[model samples]
Target: MKTDLNIINICLSDTPMQEFIRENRILGRIISAIPEIPFEKVKIGECIRKGREDLLYENKKTGAKHTKITIEEKCVYVSKVLKKVAEEHNSDFLILDGFLHYFNGAYWEKIDESVASDCISMAAEKAGFLPVEAQQENNKKKLLRQFIADYKCPPIQTKDDDLSISVNLRNGTLKYNNGEFTLRDFQKEDMLRYQLSFDYDPDATCPQFDEFLDYVLPEKQAQDVLMEMIGYCFIPTRKLKLERSMMLYGEGANGKGVIYELVKEILGKEHVTGFSMAALSFDANTRAQLSGKLLNYSSELGGKCNPDMIKKLISGEDVEVKTLYKDVWTMQDYTCKFMFNTNSLPKETEANVAFFRRWIILPFDVTIAKEKRDKKLPDKLKKELSGIFNRVISGIKRLLEREDFTESELVNRTLEEYKIRSNTVLFWVKKEGWFAVVPPENTERKSAKVPHVELDFLYEKYVAFCKKKGMHETSNATFNERIRKLFYVQTGSTNNATWVFCDKPKEKDIPVSDDTQSPKSYVERFIDNLNEEK
Candidate 1:
């Protein structure tokens, strides 16, 4: 009754007879036919009852069927069952059943295809079906991304070049002054912060440029800078090595608030959030909403922004961030450029030199009166946003044509004053008449000897200034080292370490010589030589 090769007994019979019998046997032929099944007819298990016990649970209080079940719990049980099947059959993948859609109290409901894909891909590695070892990378972010990408799904957009990668304006393309770069890697979620629409407006017209008006910036340089800010939001931040962030400062009504409001209108509420610099540094889960945002705006920045955040963003570093209920830290690009409007500057950060590189301090000098000011200015600005967007594109063109852009005199003066005030050591060096002041013999009183200062004496003044300003004082060794780097540290014959001016040459002024190098010793030696000659 059993099917076996022995039924034919080919070895015992003649060769011709054995061969003929073997050809006619059912087992001798390859599988030439397969039954086609209807799409709705197929099922992994006959009903929901056949699934794992974990899927069927009752709520403790409400007694609702399957109320205890959750995505997090169901995913674990599914991975175990799938992994067992994969190991037994050596299967690379499985066409999972429709049961994984969602658990609605008592039964499953269908979900979006993307959600289904995410559920499957997330459990792939733990199921041991993912060939991650072969790829030789274990980073969680890359691994998760690669698994989803490698598996077939609905294609949104594909981008291989990281640097060239940019947010798709949904306009189908991004046009610079010189060329057009089509948008790629257009993820709908990523654009949650791009809130501003860069949709090309062929019919949109820019308002006329007017001189002596505070509504739209009248100055060419100011106008160019504003364009760059708007244009960059459409482009990706990773494209530039360095960026300049703006801080618009002036009196009560210099149109700082209007400009800030205009930026918010252009970039929607979802894309632009009020950045409380103080709270941002201290608050938890602050970065959660900022993940996809292109710009962080603050109109009423009261004091100084945090230095640590500023330095990291300006340098294009990956910021370590966390959100509510998250156990692990996620790294996000500090791509969001900050725009601040305030009546005054905040407290100066200790690292003044590095901070100055990224800071663009612009004074809003022009103020408009009640009649002269456009009450409906914000509404008008919104209508012309598309035109302004194009203007920014043109600004990019100018930047490329000339390697350098405008730095107003106000910008230069503010930076110089910032450096002198914020930095304790630099202030003393400049004020000390080229790092050389005559040392008084008596430490008890003021020196009438000469109008110069000594290195040790200058250090005392530096420390006092820092304490009075509530700034941290560096160690004597560190202070000495920093000054030595700026100028020459002279060691006298007596093994006394003296400081002398380095006399760094410059174009504007003739280089200062080290006139106070020997001090009274030089004068004494000249007098002795004269006496010997007499």
Candidate 2:
């Protein structure tokens, strides 16, 4: 993946402070508080040349026409202003508008971009511009984070915080607007698309709402998935990575396509991506297409799906992405969340914790009968696109309020399935009357075809089991290594060694099922007995 230096919180002492802004009292109060920060004073009059401005927060002071501070100033002025407002108001959070005016990058060459961003965050945290709930290490980081979380100062433009979606957060609700879908600047050459006069409500609905919901997908999870997709649609900034990917699995004639269309319509074709699951691992060019996307809705998946590649994509780790016409591969953190429609789960996966953690399976077990299928349902749902979009926006607010994603029964079931699939060895051992491995003191061995077990014989059973399940067979070496790692299970060639199988916890002991659940609940799964490749 091609990586961009998006956001960092490293404080730099040598960040230049020589550039002086045209003196203004506001700037004076701000700069005096943080002398290391530097900025040039820009008034509303200077911005009047554009003939139009979208920053609602940038209101001009009446009868105030200030002189221009023309010195080459560092972009750290944003941090200074945040510090001033925070200290004066004793506020825990400050609006994002004030910093947009100082995003001028003329001094970018003179300042370290990462250090500059941190300085801003530090100033904000010190000034108490960050919410109390947010983690705090220092002032500059908190302020910079506040900017990233609620950066609205665009049309309010800044290269430092370039994002497609414009977020207007009030109270707990965030009004996500600006479907223009491209960052714009005053310079004519930098423009990608014309700023259209769009007045559509994000919460708009289509005409065929009831039939689409009732006749199409009756499952509650289907609705939750659609609403969550809509919530994700409004957020284009990839600051907070989505750790889990959505999978819509069921038989044909279900309402998968309609849900996909609703999300595609609202987020626009430019931001959503579609590809077969197999391409994710092998096709560099295909994966390249997903570079700047916000969501990947995969429909047709080929037989061979690489779990490792999918794991990397969903985990928000560094990935190597290929761009067409570019010879060398670039590394980027592809934070786009994925949702795939498949008839059945892949027969095989790495079955490791890394893979399971990133996969959220929503089984469309309920298939809409052919008799109940509505041919015009897509068109009807299309009519209520506005309404569907509105529901999604509302969903995002709920997600923000809740902040917990793994609260579904389907998630629990999917995790259970992952457990069984990952530990194919354990599953097979239990299925057969294999020699049982108990604590060293407790001697018990379930009778099976072989009275005495050897490392090779146990591996033979594992190989046959994998073939029976249509899964790739793990090597004997790997199997024996896993046995050694699992404390309960011991494997060796010695004649005295016991041919015992380690018992897996019953369904009641499942990790996610515990009544008491929190972030720590996820850690319930200990390091598995399977030997993990570090």
Candidate 3:
């Protein structure tokens, strides 16, 4: 009963020959009965089948026959077959964190456990380990468990350098350095785990995308900013070291939704995650969802926004994330950029300079008429993905050169307006015209006389404004502190009453500054004067 020893040799490669034979007495007995011969010339299955027939017995009374190939024996046989199959394709499989990953030519792709098990079973079946008709599924499952236990390995540790430098496109790998982009074919050494859904076609034209941008953004500067942002989303943002979240804000029927959908399509669904402001602020599980993602976005942003959490996410700080059914782990240097579209801003208890500076609010003011709205605009934009990718590349080039997003007039104006609107005290002060700038008596003087607003008068106005706007007015001490910090104004005691030395609010809009290209609000000019004096 000669048999091929190749399968046994491969399966027991890791185990001692004596140990394997002792563990499986039936297979060992069949192998021991074989005559010494070249391993490749004999078939082990034929020898095992011949030996199996000798172990069969018939029930004399009922005429029923039973074979000695028990369920346990079948599982053991199938597991050995699986081991042979696994050894043959060892380079094709990787176990990371107990998850099986299969190399699919270009990169290692994670495969579901059930899928891997099915594949292993199919391989075993092909190798002549036919499943018994009575307990095929149960037997197969047991075999898969045994195979996994024998195939365990330490997870491969992924590093930041492995994922950050190269952008994986469907066609190739794209790398950028010092304003230059190099595109090359994918290599196994690149170690990329994910890839963009679209091909990298440099000559692709996206006229529909161009038209969509023009229709939505209207201003060329805003369009450029959007393009740059989309490009920024294409790469790992932590490399840029810019910590800013973008908000597309306006009423309904605007183009914010269209832009969001287009960006998602270009980046692929797997690379982007959607989380509401409320979820991100309060849910630790939501933070875990950001792992391995390039962008985190939401269409509806509402409820209270936690400044501390928002800052941590945008600034690439370490955050604690507890994955479902896993131990708590810290996600360090998180690079996912936050982008959201909202009709109303989220409520923040403390909206300060540091918090406001991290946000870029782009106003979507244009509302397309219902009759003129294109129902198939998203479908049309999908056709131009490759061309749109080119536009994104152009933006990436410009962003790398500038080292920042395009500073548009619309963006600045919208941001400043949001800052003021979000702060009740500042909004009240701006709207009520309480603070005004006083001119210097000497034209050559660097500092101007700072006008004072009576504290009692200011507090009264603030309380009334809060009441009218349905806002909760802070205590007198808190109000005073916010005014001093936000306005950068001083306080003075005059005639037993406190006075805020913030200049009176300007009556008319000042002309745009030559250097800034934007008009300075009275509070800004006052802050500038205060800084000059210091």
Instruction: Give all candidates' CA lDDT scores.
Output: 0.49, 0.50, 0.66
Runs off by more than 4 Å, candidate 1: 1-41, 44-178, 181-199, 208-219, 300-306, 369-371, 398-413, 428-452, 460-534
Error of 2 at 42 (Å): 28
Q: Please, what is the TM-score per model?
A: 0.56, 0.54, 0.69
Query: On residues 422-530, what C-alpha lDDT tens digit does candidate 3 reach at each position?
Result: 6677677767755433321223212224446677788898999899988778788878866664343433354656655444425566443332212135546534433
Tell how far residue 52 is off in model 1, in angstroms.
Answer: 16
Predicted structure 1: lDDT: 0.49
Regarding TM-score, does 2 or 3 come out ahead?
3
**Top candidate when judged by lDDT against the true structure:** 3
Q: Candidate 2's C-alpha lDDT?
A: 0.50
Report the lDDT tens digits of candidate 1 across residue range 1-534.
Answer: 344667555433433422432353221121011112221212222225466445455568997454343233333344444334433432222211211222222111233343434334333333333323212233333333333333322222324243443333435434333354344333332322242455656456566322323353556676676666655555555555446677887886677777787777766666676776664554546744455566778776645457777566545566656655554454444466677787766655642556666777777767777776666767766667677656666655554455334656666566555655555555545544342332222233322243333467657877987788676677787677656544445445124545443332234354434643432242333223322441
Error at 386, model 2, angstroms: 1.1
Q: Model 2 over residues 1-534: C-alpha lDDT tens digits?
A: 123332222222222421222132333344346433222224334345655333213328674444443211222345445644534632212222122223221110111334435445444333333322112344434445445444333232434355433422111122233422222222221211111112235545554775666555565655665577556534443533456677776777677776667666656565678887788888877876675466788776676878888877776566676555546465454446788887777656644666666666766555777777777766666556556655665666555556535266665666676566566654555455232333323334444442344556677778987888777776776676554433234444256564634333345344532322322211222233322433
